[model samples]
Target: MLERFIAITADFSIIIPFIYLLFKGKIPLTISDKLIYVYIVLTLIRNIASFVTMMLGVYNIYLYNWYNLLSFGIIAALYFQILNNLYFKMLVIAALILLIAIAFIDYRTLLNVRTTEFNRFSFNASGCFTILFILFFLYELIRKLQVKKLTEYPLFWFSSGALLYYSGTIFPYIFIQYTFNNLANRDLYWIIDAVLSIVLSVFLCFSIRHMKHQKTV
Candidate 1:
C-alpha cells in the first residue's frame, strides 16, 4: 500500500512542472525550451495512462517501451540543439535512430513471450545514452565556461536531474526482470524509482520555472 501510494504520487508529481509551464504565459521560443515543454507533456500523458492501466490491471509494459523511445528522442533533440559540436549533434541523431530500431526489434521479438515484462534492452540503452548526453553537455559547459553560475543555468538543472534519475535507475532497470520475479525486490525497485522520479520532477520544475533566465550556449 505504501509502495503504491508513493508510486502514484511520484507519477502525478509531474503536474507540478506541467502546471507551472502552462500558466507561466510565456511561449517556448528556443528549440530546447520547446522540447522541454513537449517532454513534460509527453511524460504527463504517459504517467496518466500508466496509472489507469495499473488500476485496470492491464498489461502496460508497452506504454513504458513507447515512453522510453519518445522521451529519449525529445531529450536527444534538446542536447542536439544545445551542443555546438557537429560531431556530437550527429552522434545524438545516430543514437536516436539506433534507439528507435532497438526498441522496435525488442518489442517485436519479445511481444509473444514477454508481453508483461519491461523492455530491458531498450530501457538500459536509453538510460545509458541519456547519461552520456548529460555528461557531454556538462563537459561542454565546463570547457567553455559559458555560465558563471551553474545553478542559474536551466539546462544545468535539467541535466543534473536527468543524470540523477537515469544513473540511479540504470542498474535496477537492467535487472528489472529478475526484480519483477521477486515481489519484495520489485517493491523496493519501485520505491527507489519513485523517489528518484520525484527528485527529477522537482528539478524539472526548477528548470522550467527559471526558463526566463536561460542563457544561450
Candidate 2:
C-alpha cells in the first residue's frame, strides 16, 4: 500500500510539469519542445487507458509498456535535438526501429487473447529501447568533446536526467529479464524507476524554464 502511495505521488509529480506546459499560453514549437509536448500528451493518454483497463480488470500491462517505448522515443529525439550532430542520426534510426518493434508487439496483444507471448515480446522490446537510451548518452558523452557544452543549453538537464535514469535502470531491468524469475522483491525495483521519473521530470521542467527565460533576454 505504501509503495502504491509513493508511486502515485511520484507519478503525479512528474505529471505536474506537463500539466503546466499544456496550460501555458502558447505551445513551444521548436523541434525539442514540440516533441516533449507530444510525449506529455501520450503519457496522459496512456495513463487514462491504464486506468480504464485496470478498472475493467483486463490485466494488460503491454499498454503501459507501449507508453514507455513512446516515452523513450521522445527522449531519443530530444537528445538528437540537443546534440544536433550528424552522427546522432544513427541513434534516431535505432529509436525508430525500437518504436516499430514495440508497435508490432503491442498490435499482437490485441489480435491474440493470450498475452504471455505478447508480454515477452513487449518486455524484450522495451529492453531494446533502454539499450538505445543508454547508447544515446554514451555517444553524447563521447562525441561532444567539450564539457562546457553540457552547461550551455537548456536541454542539458534532459540529457543529464537520461544519464542518471539510464544508469539506475539498465542493470535491474536486464537482470530481471535474464533471470526470468518472479522474485518477491520485484516491487523494490520500481523505486528506481519512479525516482528516475521524478528526477527527470524536475530537470526537464527547469530546462524548459531556462529556455523561456532566454527567449525574453
Candidate 3:
C-alpha cells in the first residue's frame, strides 16, 4: 500500500507542468515540446487508468505496453527533428523493428489484455534504446559545443530528464524478477525510481519555462 501511494503521487505529479501548459495556451511550443506534451498527457491518463483498474480488480497493466510503444515512436520523431545523423536514423529503424516485434510477441503470447505479466523484451529493449538515443543526443550537443549554459537550453533539460530516467530504470526494471527472488529488501530501489521521476518532472517544467523565455527574448 505504501508503494502504491508513492507511485500514485509520482504519477500525478506529471500533470503539474501539463496544467501550466494548458494555462499558457498562448505560448507556442516547438515540435519537441508538442511531443513531450502528448507523452505526458498519455502517461497521466494511463497512470490514472491503471490505478482505477487496479482498484476494480481488472487487467490493465497491458495498457502501459501500448504507452511505451507510442512514447518510443514519438521520441524517435523528436530525435529525428533534433539531429540528422545516420546512426540516429538507424537507431530509429532498429527501435521500430523492436517495437513491432514486441507487439507481435504480446499478441501471440496473450489472447487478450488480461494478465499480470509484463513484456520484458519490449520494456528492456526500450530502456536500452532510450539510453542509446540519449547518449547520441548528448554527444550531438557536445559536438556543437554551444556557449550557452546547459540550464538555459531547453533540449538539454529534456534530454537530461530522459537520460536520467531510462538509465536509472534499466537495471531495476530489467532484473525485476531476479531482484524479487534474490533481494527482498527493495525499498531503496523504489526510492531511486521515485527520485528519478520527480527529477524528470522538474526538468520538463524547466524545459517549458526556458522555451517560453526563449520565445519572448
Candidate 4:
C-alpha cells in the first residue's frame, strides 16, 4: 500500500510540467519535445490502466509489452536524430522492424489470457536494443561533436532519464523468471522502478521547462 502510494506520487510528478506545456501550447522545435509530449499522454493512460488492473487483479499483458516496445522504439528514433548523423538510420529502422516482427511472432503466447505471465521476450529484447542504441547515442554525443552547454539540451536530460531508468529495470526483466513468482521480490522490483521513475519524472519536467525560458528569450 505504501509503495503504491510512493509509485503513484512519483508517476504523477510530471503532471505539473505537463499541464504547463498544455496551457503554453508551445515548445522548442525538437524531437525531445515531441517525445516528451507523447510520453506524458502515455503515462496518463498507463496509470489509469494500472489503477484498473490493480483493483481487478488482472494484468493487461498486451498493453504492458506493446507499450514497452513502443516507448523504446520512439526514444531510439529520437536519439538517432539527436546524434545528428543519419549514417546508420537505415540500420536502426531495420532493427526496429525486426523487433516488431519478433514481438508479433510471439503475440499469441504473450497474449495468453489464461497465463499469468509476462512476455519477457518482447520486454528484454526491447530493453536490450534500446540500451545499446542509447549507449551509441551517448558515445556520439561525446565523440562526434562537443556542445558547449549540453546540460541545457533537452535531449541530454531526456537521455539521462531513459538511460538511468531503463538500465535499472532491464536487468531485472532479463532475470524476471527468478523473481516473478515471489511476492516480496516483485514488490521490491516495483519499488526500485518507482524510485527510478521519480528521478525520470524530475528530469522530464526539467527537459520541458528548460524550453519555457528559451521561449521567453
Candidate 5:
C-alpha cells in the first residue's frame, strides 16, 4: 500500500543521511553538531518505534512522544546557542515549557489507550511539533534578517523546511482526527510525513553545503 511505501522511503531517506553525517570527517563537531546527532538518533528511534507498532497492526501507539521531546529539546538547545541573548533565551524557554506540558499530556494519554480505532497519538505528536516549528520558523527568519549575518542561509533553509512540514503535515492531521473509520486515513498521514522528511532533507543538504563553504573560507 501507499502507506507502507512511504514508511519505507522515510526510513531510508532520514536514516541514511544521519548515518552519513555522523561519520563524515568534514562535518564540524560543535554544540549544534552534537545536538543534531542526537536529534537524528532520536528520529531514527521514533521511526523504528512507529514501524514496530505498525507491523504489529496497532493503530494509535507510537514512540513519538518521548523521541519528539528529545528532538524539540535538541532544537531548543541549538536555538539557545544561536540566539545567545537573554530575550531569545526566555522565549525559547517559554516554548520549551509549553511543549513539555503537551508531551506529558501525550504520555499520559498513551498509557490509557487500548484500541485500534484511533490514531490520536500521531496527531498530538505531529500537531504539537507543527506549531513549534512555526514558532522556530518565525524566530529564525526574523533573527537572520535582523543580524544580516551570512549564516542566515542555514536559518532560512531550516525555516523553509519547517514551513513545508507544517503545511503538508499539520493541516491534514488536525482534520483526520475527526474521521477514525475512514480507510483512507493512513495514507493521509504517510503522505504528509513523507513530504516533511523530503523537505527537511533538502534543507539539511543545503546547510551542509553552506557549512562547507565557510570551512573553505
Candidate 6:
C-alpha cells in the first residue's frame, strides 16, 4: 500500500509544476529559465514512458540511462547560462564533454552485457558532476550576493532540489546491485528515490512560480 502510494505520487508530482506554469500563462524569457522548462517537460515524458514500460514488463533501464545523459546535459547548460565566472563556464563545458563521453562509453559497454541492468556508473557520475555544478553555483551566489532574498531565486530552488535528489540517491545507486542480490526489500532504495523525486518536483514548482517575480539569474 505504501509502495503504491509512493509510486503514484512520484509519477504525478511532476505535473504540479507543469500545471503551475500553464496557470501563470507566462513564458520564461531567459535562457536558464527556458532550460528549466525544457528539463521539466522532458522529465514528465520520461516518467510517462518509464511507467508504461514497467506496466508492460519491459526492460526500461535503457530509458533511464538515456535520461541520465540528457538530464545532465540540460542542467549543465542551465548552470553555464547562470554562472558569471568565465573559468567556471569553461569548466562546465569541459566537464560536460568528458562526462558525456564517459557515460556514453559506459552505456555501450553495458549494452553488450545486459540491457536490463542499471547504468550505475553513468548515473553516479552524473550525480557527482551535478553536485559539483551546484556547489559552483552556490559559491558564485555567495560571492555576488545579487539576490537579497535567496528563496525568491529560481536557480536556488532548482539547485536545492537537484542537490537533495542527487546527494540522497547516489549511494543507493552505487549499492543497487548488492541490494538486488542480497536484500529482501529491493524496493527500499527505489522508495527513497521516489520520495526525493517528489521533493525535487515540489522545489521545481516553486522555482517556476517564482520566475515572474524574480529577475533571471
Give residue 32's error in model 4 in angstroms.
3.3
Can you tell me which runs of candidate 4 are displaced by over 4 Å? 109-115, 181-184, 212-217
- Model 3 scores a TM of 0.85
Clashes of 4: 0
TM values, all candidates:
0.91, 0.71, 0.85, 0.83, 0.71, 0.90
Q: What does the lDDT read for residue 210 in candidate 3?
A: 70
Estimate, for each residue in 1-217, the C-alpha lDDT of model 6 and write its tens digit: 9987997799889999988878878664577778888999988998998899889888676777788888999999999887777998898889888877777666653454336566656777788889999998888788878789888888899999999999998888777566532346567677888899999999999898778545444
The reply for model 2, stretches above 4 Å from the true place, is: 98-152, 178-185, 213-217
Tens-digit lDDT track of model 3 for 21-131: 677677767777777788778877877888799789998757766777778887787777767787778878878787768766767324457754555566678878878
Q: Write model 1 residue lDDT over 70-165, tens digit each, in one string.
A: 899899989988888999999998999888777777665345533666665788889999999999999989899988888877788889999999
Candidate 5 residue 173 Cα shift, in angstroms, is: 3.4
The models' CA-based lDDT, in order, is 0.84, 0.60, 0.73, 0.69, 0.59, 0.81
Query: How does candidate 2 fare on TM-score?
Result: 0.71
lDDT of 2 by residue, 70-121 (tens): 6777766666565555766676767577667755754765455434323334
In order of lDDT, best first, we have 1, 6, 3, 4, 2, 5
For residues 1-217, what per-residue lDDT tens digits would candidate 5 score against the true structure? 8666766787656666575675566655555555555666677777776777777876444344455555667777766775546776787777777766655554554454543333444455545654564576466656556545545445445556656765666666666555432566756566667767866766665544444322100
Instruction: Give Cα distance to truth, residue 27, candidate 5, Å.
Output: 3.9
Best by TM-score: 1
Error of 1 at 145 (Å): 1.5
Worst lDDT 10-window in candidate 6: 107-116
Q: What TM-score does candidate 1 get on C-alpha atoms?
A: 0.91
lDDT of model 1, residue 37: 83
User: Clashing residue pairs, candidate 1?
Assistant: none
